[model samples]
Target chain A: MTVSVDEIGNLFARREGTQRDAAPVLIGSHLDTQPEGGRFDGVYGVLAALELVRALNDADIATGKPIEIVSWTNEEGARFTPAMLGSAVFTGVTSLEEALAKQDAQGITLADALAQSGYRGTRAVRFQAVDSYFEAHIEQGPVLEANGTTIGVVTGGQAIRWLDVTVTGVAAHAGTTPMPYRKDAYFAAAQMALELEKIAERRAPRALVTIGQASIANASRNTIAGKVAFTVDLRHHDDNEVDAMERDLRAAFASAAKTRGVEVSIETYWRSPATPFAPSCVALVAQAVDALGYSNERIVSGAGHDAIHLARYCPTAMVFIPCVDGLSHNEAEDALPEDVTRGANVLLNAVLARAGVAATLNAK
Target chain B: MTVSVDEIGNLFARREGTQRDAAPVLIGSHLDTQPEGGRFDGVYGVLAALELVRALNDADIATGKPIEIVSWTNEEGARFTPAMLGSAVFTGVTSLEEALAKQDAQGITLADALAQSGYRGTRAVRFQAVDSYFEAHIEQGPVLEANGTTIGVVTGGQAIRWLDVTVTGVAAHAGTTPMPYRKDAYFAAAQMALELEKIAERRAPRALVTIGQASIANASRNTIAGKVAFTVDLRHHDDNEVDAMERDLRAAFASAAKTRGVEVSIETYWRSPATPFAPSCVALVAQAVDALGYSNERIVSGAGHDAIHLARYCPTAMVFIPCVDGLSHNEAEDALPEDVTRGANVLLNAVLARAGVAATLNAK
Candidate 1:
């Protein structure tokens, strides 16, 4: 029950090592869940990290570096917003003040919720130079299971760019206005979305585009929309490709609007560059899997993880086990017990290699 | 204050003529206004009709048929489900019970609103074969004014069709789903709207199309939409042209969905067939305008009028004066004073001819 919370509500349980002066090796995922969330999506990673520490104690193995198991707050961002808030704050990607000031659907600020939940701690989030970082998670997609593989040595994460688009047109009576005289905002928005999709397909196997959300302001069944706003999400394996895709998207929207005599504006809301994990950290994970003789495949993560933030400051890698149907973030998400054990074993050995074994344990 | 309300809330003010046994010549328009309505749209028609009857009495001219002025309920449908509720019910276009049961935004029934306003009456709506019907109104468009004409003999009303469209696709993480694997609903909906515009342009100067309302269900700024629903408003001067346009629209939507690997459904929500006023009624009004030496032109009404319902069971026609900038359903609607007087004079002479001036005004 000894849990220490950081200012942004991240929790950590520390396991002391023999070398008290050394920076700890961090191992964690997130603890928050989606609304219709699975039981093992995030819980498995935290539990496995704790189990790894227990196994070391049982075997009387001593490490030179401390091991700290972390549970990042609001990783799902389902209740609040901007998922991975705790990791983003701890890694300095976002300020702690901004993270705490974020509000939920009920108009309650993150700081307020943390205080109400009694998880707001006096400790500030200060990043000490870490030995290494590792995250174990269920493969949220069907890549691993479909391949008949048990473990995934995650290589990197996809880059993402979010664009907010606003289209403005003249609002008139839908029945009375002739088509030639209308500058319809919804029509322009539709064209923008279709063009984005085509651009993605033209660069297929690499670029991905999605018109995630769109809306006409004060929409009614009988009134022509005057203003429409939507969001475009573009992802690719390379940062330069994403930038090119975004430029194409912007030009397409401008062209559509100009042809229709409407107005359009595009702005970037978020951008996350592609992240390739440290080669040494990745090799250590791969060596552990090979030693354990577990079937494995090299894979790239499509979904964002706390490891992305940690990668900004230290050596970081991830391990993934197969999930039933490759579905995470859903209530029906499931993972096999044996696969879970294998992923934990990979995590245990990878953590050990980075947090070196003490001479006492080596002698034994 | 001496008005009488029917079961469906239509208000009637009857003036006794010399002959009590003959059918009355009905003359009026709606009294309700649009949410952002003009000062003289429906009010001008009702007030002008009342003034016509008062002039007949002041001139000491008797008529064989009585004159009844009406103010139709919910004519704007701004506070109800359907417009022209009163006239539609009175002329048997819609059932009295159905019109009475229509609800407003707050879930308040038309019956309740009528009751709350103390206008719900016990008087039963009885239709008697009328001698003739005449409606005087401001032309809510620029045709007559733009051409330097003062009066418009409204010969007919345009047919209208409303189609509800729904698009279905797979919802997924906007950031994770690949372009080839995703069936985004908004994209399909956008393509449908653009295709409809093309279809409308192909049948230009005859058929009109407008996408009035659209919505994406479970919309999120970062999640691909699974379902999108919108309404299409189609209009034309001929029923056959409108029918052809609708078929083309449906085919285009189905094709868009198929090509995009999504599902689409189009349903009709409302329809109003084109109405051509009785030739005899139109001619009598034309002759009166000619005799009065008013500059006039025959025009088709772009918007719905109460006379459209009256034309179903009786000889009916409309007289229109120009509105400033051809704008109605707006707060800036304006009409010239002389145009109003001229329209009233046309109404006076037209009513005189249909009701048969009892040999008194005819001799004078």
Candidate 2:
């Protein structure tokens, strides 16, 4: 195994080919886990890619294009946030300096952690040198298993928008202040939450709206809430639909605040636009699954992955194997070995198609 | 000034009279201040009571019954919660043991704090020997000031009920979970809040409903909220009305949770029944206000005071003077000197009527 580390600590294992200058076909995922992470999440994808390289070696197959297995860093983002940092930086979506400067909860910078862990390297990773990318991962939701499918040919990732909402109202004695005199912040916030649910309902199966974090300042059991702040996460497959959803949420909040005699401010914090895989790459992955005679279906990724970042710079697709109950980022996550083997086979064949088997060409 | 401390830290200063067996008239309020308290909230009432005694002594006017002034402890409850601990114990609303056991955020108990401050005493303060009680305070609301009134003869205090609510839903990925599948806790909580406000509006002019504190566990910016806990405070002058308000709030919350397919639990944390002072005592206070030739009005106390506890056991009344903009419990709180003097005169006359002038009786 030939291994190299990039400046941001991405580990790349390359298997040499007949032509070194020919762009390599990249296959990999991240190598991080959530606080209560399962063993198979990021680790499964990395191991599967490594197994693909081993199987090709066992078959005595050399390709025109080199094979590289990558292990991205901080994709879970539980320790250091803004996930998929390694791939984002490699593709130039984020600067290497910024990713290195990112700090964890303990205030330890990424660069410091890499240096301390002895993974810091001078080698630079270039996305332009990657001919194509394929990743194999466990489905983090109940979609595949519930449908009794063994494989999921991921077509694209959903659009994501994060909004920060602040509701300002008059704080008064809960026992003394009459309803007419109150500009209760919680009341306005509650109305906004309810209205957001309604908006999501109107959009139906494609909409995913959630209120995750909420808090009020000077909170007490008896005083009226004066100010409340919460986070809203809206997701959809279409970028225009996601934008419309945000507009609806803002308008609803404005109306609710006005009716309650409160003030509200909604700020869009971060956004990830929908990333659709190249049709040819998606078809190739699906064809591999069909040729292997695996139960499979087309699906969209509910969660972000390194593939989403790589998709922006090159043709990319992902193969998903069913996880037990689709539970992920949790310690209780489990998967069957047979499914893992099937996923690896599909990944190997898909990579072989892109890299072009040199032995087969010589034989011909 | 013969000052003595009680076992629970109440400060009593007695002025002896010819008939020591006669029940003494009690006059005063608490001396504690809020964290961001004004100089004139409880302090004004206390100083006014002390000044009233000084004026009577300077004029050589003695009463038939003994006169005593008390300074209640922990009225603000900012440091140790469940305010009015001293008065509540004095009137038997809360047991002395419970009051002593109540701890602050720092885990310091009331008994420990009093002992550390050297305020704990061996003297046993008895409310049975008290003939009547009068408290002079600044109106902490805009009703009197907005109406251009100088003094308010407080008739009674409003009833207060504190309820705790918890909403439980399913936590899932914001980008993957469809609207139909999500049992969003924040949505249920928000709907309940909005409905509660509407319920209060239905009972408007008297209902005082508020949601003070709210929180979601394991909250993140992208995941759906799994659980939300909040406090609801409802108050009214009519005990039956407050009960109905509680019923309405519970029903609304139950319905909202059911609609959202979420679980909810409502707990009643605390309750203070409405206390109406004796008609005779209220009339005497109004008479004193009229005799002082001040622009006065009969008003109900929206906030809890030491008088409410005392009212349960004896004839108790309160004299309120207008504060600038009716702002209290804030460092920016202010009141005109004339208003203070006017309230003091009204309190003096009321106490004189109850205590009876010994010199005038001797002359007769």
Candidate 3:
């Protein structure tokens, strides 16, 4: 997941005793790392499954149900964006061509990256054949380690709302116009942004409001700003807070417009209600962790993942292991091989428990 | 000063005489209005000078400096920025060629407009030969008119500074990257822009801050703003206020940057300090008003004008007229012909008070 988002070169390692069967349970984390990120996040998830395959092979016994381990591409969005690039496409939230055509900052398209990285495949969305999907990852946050838990059985991820604010102002000769004589736009926008922080502060803890993007029109050092636009990303576990905050934020903006003499337009660009882990998937994941003799404390996932997108189509679950000092998607991302093995052990047994799933050894 | 900024038409009038002494004391304002606009601004100023010329002619004062009235081109800079086009060129702030070469929003150059207008002038900067420059304009504010004053003597005009803020952020897909997971540039910029009002507010009652231009990289409704840039115009009559606001604003920006993982760059494109009117010119103006038995008040010109530039070389003064409701630069801008006549009277007297200004003799 570096500069180029194409050609995700991912390899699958199946247990020697594993066999391909209908309705296989798919399990593995993305193989890519966050740019300048933690090593164990996506990589550890895949490695854990591979370790499961290796350990299972040693047992010399093939379960009736088959399981497959595969690593998806562009999970961290380091080189490519819309993170979880593979899963979003797999679930049909995004089209393959669209995903492949997505461009990076350098103007390199995902299709071009695929050709460059040699990871392009004709295979259909993985969810089409899988009975269930499971991802093992390192918890990017310190919640797991702080609680002294060996693993985190994520209950679900939080809901997110992305807002884009575009404020329009007449472009004027800055030097010729005086302060009180002219209508200034950036002033109103800036005030609103600060007010949003105050709103966030009031909402505190649950309502996380971030002013991520700010922009201006015909922006020159010498001209009065003709337009001002920005982005507000607000996440909340509760939908009402999201709704309320949106209203409050909008009201604040409207008032600002009346006072500042500039026109403002806002659009809700994206919205995703928080999706909790399905109870069945949560229970199965817990059972697998218990079978492996590891502690399973639940925590909320602060970040989005492919599982969230896949939730739209099939039941999905995520397993998190501790990366070194709870760091992921960083250059310092590291984890012990044993921890990777332990997480994979749980993943292996969990996949095996699912009915109608099979171990796969398909010839390419 | 329409779209064809270069061609404002021919400049001429009855000199009343043909000799050097017949050249009237030139008095008038620009014909152009700001593009987005306000009325009774430039247009009224010119009408005031013309009304004064008519009154002088009607009175049959053939020996007095024969008054000439004019309407300069591209004053408000609606089509072409850097307002006061004709005046600036005359003052040598920039060359006529440069002004003519300036481009409009449609990317058409001023040279193109000049060709269309057929108004290319052969005259060079005539600061030495020209008589006193007097302009009558609206108060544009409630300062004097509210006090029931009929005339205002401008002591000086405030300085102005224009800036462009360019923020570099990593553009990523808004959907795939969790709000927390992505380094959204627009968000950070939002914080910067939103805080602008607070920046100005902290200095309260004096500091002026505006963000007029805002833009983003890969500006899609569903994309995390990666690269954002905007313009900020900070203006103040008090240099300390401008300095202090800038320092504090930059610090707040740094704080936001530290909190949000984004890079920001601010480039100062324009800076001009406040210019004070000449005491001698101011005295001459006050005399004109006092001699006419008109109400008088000394005030700061709320806007920049040709008088500001001309003041550097020769004596420049501004007379005041009221816009019905103190509105200028709007489509509804209005000023009565009587007010225009009053302003002209002040301008004519001020010019005549200066010795050696030979208009009738020059004409003969």
Q: Which candidate is the best by lDDT?
A: 2
TM-score per candidate, chains pooled = 0.91, 0.94, 0.70
Greater DockQ among 1 and 2 belongs to: 2
- Taking all chains together, the TM-score of candidate 3 against the true structure is 0.70
Q: How does chain B of model 1 score on TM-score?
A: 0.92
lDDT of 2 by residue, A297-364 (tens): 99889889999999998899999998886677668888889999999999998988888888842332
DockQ, all models: 0.53, 0.68, 0.19
Candidate 2: segments with Cα more than 4 A from true spot: A126-128, A336-338, A360-364, B126-128, B360-364
Q: Model 1 off-target regions past 4 Å?
A: A58-60, A142-152, A289-300, A322-326, A336-338, A359-364, B54-63, B139-152, B288-299, B336-342, B359-364
lDDT of each model, Cα atoms only?
0.85, 0.86, 0.67
In DockQ, how does model 3 score against the reference complex? Answer: 0.19
What is candidate 1's TM-score against the reference? 0.91
Tens-place lDDT per residue, model 1, A269-359, is 9899999998899999999999999999998778888988888878999999998876667788899989999999999999999888874
Who is ahead in TM-score, 2 or 3?
2
**How would you encode candidate 1's per-residue C-alpha lDDT over B96-194 as one tens digit per residue?**
888878989999998898899998987787565577789999987666887899899989888989899999997766655556667888888888988
Docking class of 1: medium
User: Ten consecutive residues with minimal summed lDDT in candidate 3 chain B?
Assistant: B1-10
Q: lDDT at A305 for candidate 2?
A: 93
Leading candidate by DockQ = 2
iRMSD computed for candidate 2 = 1.5
